[model samples]
Target chain A: MIPFRFSYHKPSSLSEAFEILSEDGAVPMLGGTDLVVKMRAKRVTPKVVVDLKFIDELHNVSFSEDEGLVIGAAVTMNELIEDFAVVKERFPVFYQAIKKVGAYQTRNRATVAGNIANSSPAADSVPPLLTYNAKVKVVSADGERLVELKDFFTGPGRNVLKPGEIIHSIIVPYESPSIGMYYKISRIKAVDLSTIGVALTIIDPDGKRDIRVALASVAPTPVRAFKAEDYIRDKELSASSVERFAELVQESTSPITDARGSKEYRWEMAKVLPKRILRELGLFEGVA
Target chain B: MTITLNVNGKNVQVDVQPNETLLDVLRNKLYITGPKEGCGNGECGACTILYNGKVVNSCLVLALEADGAEILTIEGLTKDGRLHPIQEAFIEENAFQCGFCTPGFVISTKALLDRNPNPSNEDIIEALAGNLCRCTGYQTILKAVKRAAEKLGVEK
Candidate 1:
């Protein structure tokens, strides 16, 4: 049984939810997949648990060519997988990362917003969201603001969100003409957290090739490989170039040794995954 | 606070604490013990149940969150003294040795079949990934799902 008790509030509107969030010791819950686990473990004991599922605006998953995709805080992973064709065709890296977030049962209730809001270093969704240049829309009684996914996290299990703020939606800008892929190294094939997750997006916007690479579980927060991305951008794909790119990618991580894997192993994988992904993308013709 | 939950096709109102889990309320107050609490956390899907037609770990769902929703547990799989086809298939296939994890597997399989009446082997494996079994080796359980799919007249 849960050891502690908290008052539950289900608000029907965004303003009402924001007002409830302003209460002292109040926590906003979207799917409760992560929060419930934490509550059971006594990691957090909020006096009030604000359930956000009742807010109509928080359940939407709308997309348009001009405005791109806006995933509401309550939109489940399964809902994103099933409803958004753009996720499948345009942002397949995000789709693949969502598939690895959890098993089907948990994914049925786990939300994209919660995945980011949790801010776990090993969270599978973060790297891909980073590659997509996603923006998090957070609301409070004060006002609303959009934080870029890159600048969202401050540390493991922490973000820039103020105590009174709750994420309203996540905005993914219009799909650029690009090829993207997500690669994750996990302990098991199913229902496991990522030991190392990588998302790479190669775009040729305005005839200038741009490469973006993001890695998870290799640092305090999911981070982009800026140096490595710059090194490979506009460069011809070659075995040596990709090898050097992987080396730069490895240099960017600051992983720690934990039960899941060793620091050294993660460092090596931080390099290996990018090379493997590049090979799979046919950017490199020969095995390195 | 009191919450009304639609369980097994019937609405039952029960007084539950704000932090009480749906599994706790179901087993303690409502006496719907079909869902077992193998792990209070969601890792073990022994408490799997259908919430609004989607399979979820009831242990992770707050009882208040379940209010105004429909839930189907292992006990609800039977109707008019007739076992669900999935349960019948499990029995015919000898899918359980200790039978402790049967309820969760049955519920998960029911959810999978409802969505994809004819699931492939990979699909079946993916759907049952969250549910674990210590007694049976899962081969018979796979066969049971296949048999149930055939019994439901949508075999692939």
Candidate 2:
């Protein structure tokens, strides 16, 4: 049980929620998947917990050809899974990555906004968002702004979010004729955190090939492997070229030795996983 | 905070602290102890319950969150003094030794069946992955789920 006493505020609108969040020691809560746990552990002792579920604007999920996909902060993992058709058709790699967020029950309560807001280095969803060049719509009583997902993180469990600023929604731009993949090494097959997560997206619209690669749990925050991506972009992903690309990707990581895995192991897997995924996708052919 | 909850088909009002969890309110104030607290955190699903017909760990849910919510605990599984089919199947299959995790398993099975009446073996495994049992080897639980599914009169 939580030992601290905290006031609860269930705001019915975005403005009201913003007002509540602007107060000192007030934290915005979406699904309570992360905040509640932190509260119970005394890691986050807020004087007031602002519940955002009552705000209708925060529960919306909309997609269009021009506007792309807009997923509100309150969209739960289960809601996304139920809308799998659109997600699979639009962002297949994101659909695959979100499916690995948590177990079924936890997903029922975990929200996409919370996962991104938590800013864990091993977050399963961040890498895919990076691959998609997603943007976070941050709002406050003052105003609103959109931050690129790549520049959102500042450190482990921290972001550039100012006090009273809440993530309103995530905006993923639509890409046609694209293919992507996400791979992660975890302790258990399911219901476990990622030791090293990798996501790759290749967009070939109008015959202009573009590749984006991102990794998680290998740095202070989730990062894109820009060097490897640039090295392999528009080039035939032959075995040797892909090997060199993987080495560059490995060089980009700065993983630390922890109880989950050794720094050497994470760095090695950072190289091996992308290559394995590339080979599986038939982008690279090699001898067995 | 004082909140009214629709629990087990009954509207009950209880006073709870803002920091209290749904599990705490269910066991302490409501006097419904079917939901066990094996892990206060959500890692273990022993505190699983149906919130708005979807399975969620009660320990992770705040008491304030359930103010106007409809909750179904293990105590609500029976009807007309007869055990639910899943409960009966558990008995016939001897699905539990400690029984601490049985409530969560039963609740999750109900949810799975409600969504997919004829779930494959892999489907059952995936649906029940969050609930952990130290005894009965889980094979018996699988058999019990199969039996329950059959008794629910859905084609395999």
Candidate 3:
């Protein structure tokens, strides 16, 4: 189906793109792997579309020793998978989730930024990004600001980003001793959005342990289960303890029954997976 | 608007509408029909094409999104009607039965080979996951991809 009538502007530079976005309800598009289809379905229609494909800066992927990993808004999932650091730096969990999003064809077209900006409760990337305690760098006609990934989304398909503001990049904070695990539950193995997604990361720095559990499709937004973390802290990271914590996480969440999965099933998986992950990282002891 | 795009190693100019998908412009306005339209949305890989050296579903990308970009379709794989090694491997192996999905498979396989000259059977499976074919049952198609990679001079 053809999208609703709209004017398209291909901006050569980000400044030009910003100027366009500043217009009332003007939208900036990158990759368009999701937005175009959404538009065709009448989910969203705008007076104009500011195409950011020509803006080279928006598609950049950079690595640094001091600052950390910075991915541009237009960086595709296929490019992210090719990164040696992302795949090999003890983050195999992410590779698993990224591998499950759509198919090889969709990954080649889907942008990490687009997934985040869409802010769907079921987006596979959000839980992981939230688990990493990632940061979103947004730009607008007013100025630029960095919002913690957890704070970026206010509710399902809703975000704090105001009109004329665009997400510029996402930052995964640099940490030397970090272990991350990600998992997603879907009805079919291919191309379906997550029914519930979870990203678990534990970092032991200077003998201070920071465990982050971020999940999606469990609440109005992908959120961190702080109450669950509080229950397990200072306990010798063990299987039984992890199990106890997982149960607490299930209790804390208000999962709903949607087309993807029932509220009860989401709660059960939410409890089961995190404990299993904690065990894999030697944070649990009950497993043989 | 008039946009300059490089297609099949030749620089071409075309008039584009703002809302039209790249697949529409490539198949209709520019007349490069190698990329077929299976699902106008990105669910199917039939309209897959290379945009700036990265494989993308053309149907999901707007025509203006591809301006000043380098594009390669099934038509661009061979030079002067010479069959690309992958192309030959597809025909020789009879990798496809219905042939509608063959072009997308061949193009996506080309992308895999270009990036990783030595991909495992698992890699081949993942790369072709988005392209569906009811005819081949995937065994022959998988072998054909491995054959192309071998022809590209990669071990395993």
lDDT, model 2, position A162: 93
Go through the candidates in order and give the clash count of each.
0, 0, 5
> Per-residue lDDT tens digits of candidate 1, residues A161-183?
99889899999886576676889
| CA lDDT of every candidate | 0.88, 0.88, 0.80
- The reply for model 3, stretches above 4 Å from the true place, is A59-66, A80-96, A205-207, A282-288, B80-82, B154-156
The CA-based lDDT of model 2 is what?
0.88
For model 2, residues A85-106, the per-residue Cα lDDT tens digits are 6787778778888878767888
Candidate number with the higher DockQ (1 or 3): 1
- Candidate 1 local Cα displacement, residue A183, angstroms: 1.6
Docking class of 3: medium
**Model 3, span A10-118: residue lDDT tens:** 7877788878887776887776867888898888897888877668888777767566678888777877877545544634445566777888778877777888888
Candidate 3 overall lDDT versus native: 0.80
Pairs with backbone N, CA or C atoms under 3 Å apart (clashes), candidate 3 = A237-A283, A238-A284, A238-A285, A239-A284, A239-A285
Report residue A178 deviation for candidate 2 (angstroms): 2.9
